[model samples]
Target: MSADHYFSADPAAPARPGTVEFSVAGRDYTLAVASGVFSAGRLDTGTAVLLRKAELPTAATGGTLLDLGCGYGPIACVLATEAPSTIVYAVDVNARARELAAANAEALDLAGRLRVAAPDDVPADVEFDEIWSNPPTHIGKAGLHAMLERWLPRLAPDGVAWLVINKNLGGDSLHTWLAGLGWVVSRVASQRGFRVLRVARKTA
Candidate 1:
């Protein structure tokens, strides 16, 4: 497989643009997406499931939230809309995805609350109050694990991360592995063969 598989720093595919329409908590979103990004054709089913099954942030939820592997800013945009006062950081490795995310945030008039940055661009000292992701499981177990290991530790004390994974793709094994890593991992919900995992740092 080519390295341009959504996580590449730069994708060379022709930019075929389109829009994805979805609603969360009665709020509608029609965001632009294009080729060379994750789920460019539509709002990915896993992501839709994640948003629908996971507990969404409320207006009172105020703090820095990380949208890990943000593709075109869907999760970041939704988070910004739900908690207007919070800072939503959308981090991705793909430059095209970052550009599209910035544009989407701007289109939603959420540019002030949304911060689009490459993975390394985010300040090292900053920690997240919450982290949400529909991770790129296609990256294989080792790569996926490494990616999580790098970011999950950045969760602030008492913070949690909500993740969605396909059951067929070692979801249960991942839960076990995370538990071994000392995280408090639980199966929050499951639907259409997808598992929604709630992970938090274990208290000392």
Candidate 2:
């Protein structure tokens, strides 16, 4: 059995370069992908649902944004393209994914606004105005929760985080878990067995 996984810090699988083409908000994207990254073959269903259902930022949107677990820069690219005035930081644990994400950003002329970096490489002082992700459930409950615990607090006081989770993969439970952590999480949309969640800090 191979130890390689998309979440692996360093995937042992040889990089087989490819491309994934998908349309979002009427805009077409052809991003570079490889075997070591998440959803290398196509846009992930959960991610697609998140992108389709979430309230995407517009050209007027500014401030820093974060694309957590950004694989190959799909979400990062889209966010940067949609919000021309915003700076997007795409963070991922996988080194190969980071490389592919940076390449994709550069290819789409979004490199100026999109920054790709490994998780630890992101500046600790930076806080995001918006955060987006389709988390890795396969990492198990503890790991997933740890990932959220590490990132959710980095949101600006009024910042919002958009997430998509598979209903079969503890989507509802995750929502409740986030709420238990004091976040105000709501199911903004549900489609194709995926739940799109909008999460924000609770206001007094």
Candidate 3:
């Protein structure tokens, strides 16, 4: 159903909240989940592959970071936790997702550096040093491309973006597509039927 997707501004489903616990980079997390958000049961496999395979930020890392389509803020939380100096913007279109992500950031004591906002709510002037995402490919290729077009340009000239897509769901084709768009794309990692792509502007 079109209404079932997490990109909806408001989900009509019953809240029916619960918790999903998972670990990242050897640290554990227990996050709040409800009926309307993405992967409320556990960490999605694509995200797991992205986190495990992509290059993670370090404490020495600074500047703005974007977690595009951040669901419950798992990637954002990990980013903020690993790179204390970075300010992370966790953007989601769903109201419930923003609320839960904000709460999760607060619970992890990362509220000071993490901002959870709707995609349209983010400040237009912010540019990211690094962008992380497990983009919603189920939205269809055109919509997915539009979402990337809207945010990818915000990456700082020296910045990089990490993205994960299901191989069976057009991963290889998406890589070719990004490359065709003038971005330097690479299949940096693959696991569990997911492709972890590193995307960035080409160097002269």
Candidate 4:
């Protein structure tokens, strides 16, 4: 069995190069991909759903956006393209994924606006104007919750986060959990067995 998880810092699988093409908001993207990375053979279904369902940034949106667990820069690249004035932080724990994401961003001419880095490499005080993620649900409920706990607080007071979760992977429970954490979570969309969640800080 393949011991490779998308979270593996250095995936040992052989690098099999490929390309994944997808369209979002009427824009088409063909990003270079390779083995040993998340969804190397194709654009991930969750991410595709997230992109299709979530509200993307506008051309005038000018602020820092966070793409948590950025596999190969799809979200970051799209954000950079859609919101040229905004800066995108593509963060992941996997080194190879980071490399691939950086390369993709550069290939897309988004390197100037996209910053790819490991989680700890992101500056502590940097708050995000928006966050986009299709979290690794296979990491288990506890791990997923911990991941959210670490990043969700970094959202600016008015910032919003768009997330895609498998309905069978604690999606509804996560929504309830976020509400318990004082976040205003809403199910913005549901399609192809996935749930799109929009989360924001609750105003008291």
User: Among all windows of ten consecutive residues in candidate 4, which has the lowest summed lDDT?
Assistant: 1-10
Would you list the C-alpha lDDT of every candidate in the order shown? 0.93, 0.94, 0.92, 0.91
* Ten-residue region with minimum lDDT total, candidate 3: 1-10
Find the 10 residues in a row with the least total lDDT in model 1: 1-10
**Per-model TM-score versus the true fold:** 0.97, 0.98, 0.98, 0.97
After the best TM-score superposition of candidate 3, give how far the Cα of residue 81 lies from its true spot, in angstroms: 0.5
| Model 4, residue pairs in steric clash | none
Q: For candidate 2, report its TM-score.
A: 0.98
Clashing pairs in 1: none
* lDDT per residue as tens, model 3, 1-204: 668578888898877798988888888989888889999988889988898899999989999999999998899999999999999999999889999999999999999999999888899999999999999887899999999999999999999999999999999999999999999999999899999999999988
lDDT of candidate 4 over 33-140, digit per residue (tens): 888778988888889999988989999898999999999889999999999999999999888889889999988899988999999999999999999999988888
Order of quality (lDDT): 2, 1, 3, 4
Best by lDDT: 2
Model 3 spans > 4 angstroms off = none
